[model samples]
Target: MTDKYSAGVLLFRRGDGGVEVLVGHMGGPYFARKDNGAWSIPKGEYEPELEDARAAASREFHEELGLFVPAGDWIPLGDVRYSSGKGKKNLIVWAVEGDLNPADVVPGTFEMEWPPRSGRMANFPEIDRADWFDLATAHDKLSTGQRPYLDRLNDYLTQTGE
Candidate 1:
């Protein structure tokens, strides 16, 4: 019923007359079998005490992508809201330009019990795999709630040439 606020970055790099954005496939057993519409930008929740959602966003990006993202001028592309009746989530978005290598990426891992009741624990990468996709493909691959960030980034680039 209430809205929860979160932050994420739309990392992009120039490529072959267009731009490619970095989108991460969520890890863990829940998302291991999923494909389209399951990936998302590196992001997470933060409390007001944190005071800097952009900083939190950058930190989450580094942790999830296993690379440092400089805290530079962030192009605020506003937010996207998604609700499932149980709760509403607001995603604050920003556009960042950077180069990232999927091969070199070593996402952080979490220990979880596999096979549900088997009680066997295994480590899963925080982000199973990351890839760069053009705006159209990214829109389809990203989570339903996060597609807006790509749209907004495209609009911003069209309007600002950045």
Candidate 2:
């Protein structure tokens, strides 16, 4: 099977004496009714020609969040396998320090049929909502495999005192 890959950013901010991370809720009909582990970091797939997955992650964030994230220092948190069994080689993860305003988010759009087989087209936001959550809460809200990215971030911060 061909290997698939995607990348995401774990954006964090120091607040209330701890770090809080920003996560996004997937949009569209399939994910609309789900919660508590349905949300994910803003990310997407790209061809090898793209080369830089980190740049793709940053671009995807802008497309999904409608904001510019300065290319500051990024800490590589390695990669993790998704549970979907899509032959994903791994999800390249990174820790980026930045501030995001959930209120300003204007997610990208996708075209899909509202009612199955109805053939009526509609647009849906790439992400329905985004929020900041503490690590524990994020663990429950994020995909099971993606949780390691959070732990890796904490480990990096602890080691570097960032």
Candidate 3:
């Protein structure tokens, strides 16, 4: 089977406290009770054959967070591959420097069968909430598979002296 691919934007900003990243808490019941390791970069899966990765990233960023992505130079943070259940998947991410109030977020929604096997369908926000966390806090908040993007962003900033 072909591996699945996803693309996303890692929105960050530099402040007096240093760098901070905006991430979302994954919605739905499975992640409802979790905190640590439950947050993820705002993203969504896309079929590579049907869409360009960068465009897809922008689309997903809007869909997931209900916010217009800030205009800036998107610094490529590259991609990482990880196993998901029985299949492998790749995530491509780019870092863009910008700031926005988390409270302004109006997250989009997704429909899924709640309680796993019930016949009823429920709509849940793609992300229950969004917040800005300092680099260290962000490191702990992001899911393991997506954590490498942070390091990549740091390297890019360091190399450019940003």
- Best-performing candidate as measured by lDDT: 3
Residue lDDT tens for model 1, 77-159: 88778963359887787888888788877898889889898999989998999999988888888888888888788888889
Candidates by lDDT, descending order: 3, 2, 1
Whole-structure CA lDDT of model 1: 0.83
Clash count of each predicted structure: 0, 0, 0
Give the whole-model CA lDDT for all candidates, comma-separated. Answer: 0.83, 0.84, 0.91
CA lDDT, candidate 2, residue 159: 93
TM-score winner, 1 or 3:
3
lDDT of 3 at 91: 92
RMSD of each: 2.2, 1.8, 1.1
Choose the strongest candidate by TM-score.
3
Model 3: per-residue Cα lDDT over 1-162, one tens digit each: 779999999999998988899999999888899998899998889999899999999999999988978999999999899876558889999898999889999999999998788988999988999999987888898888988989888888899999
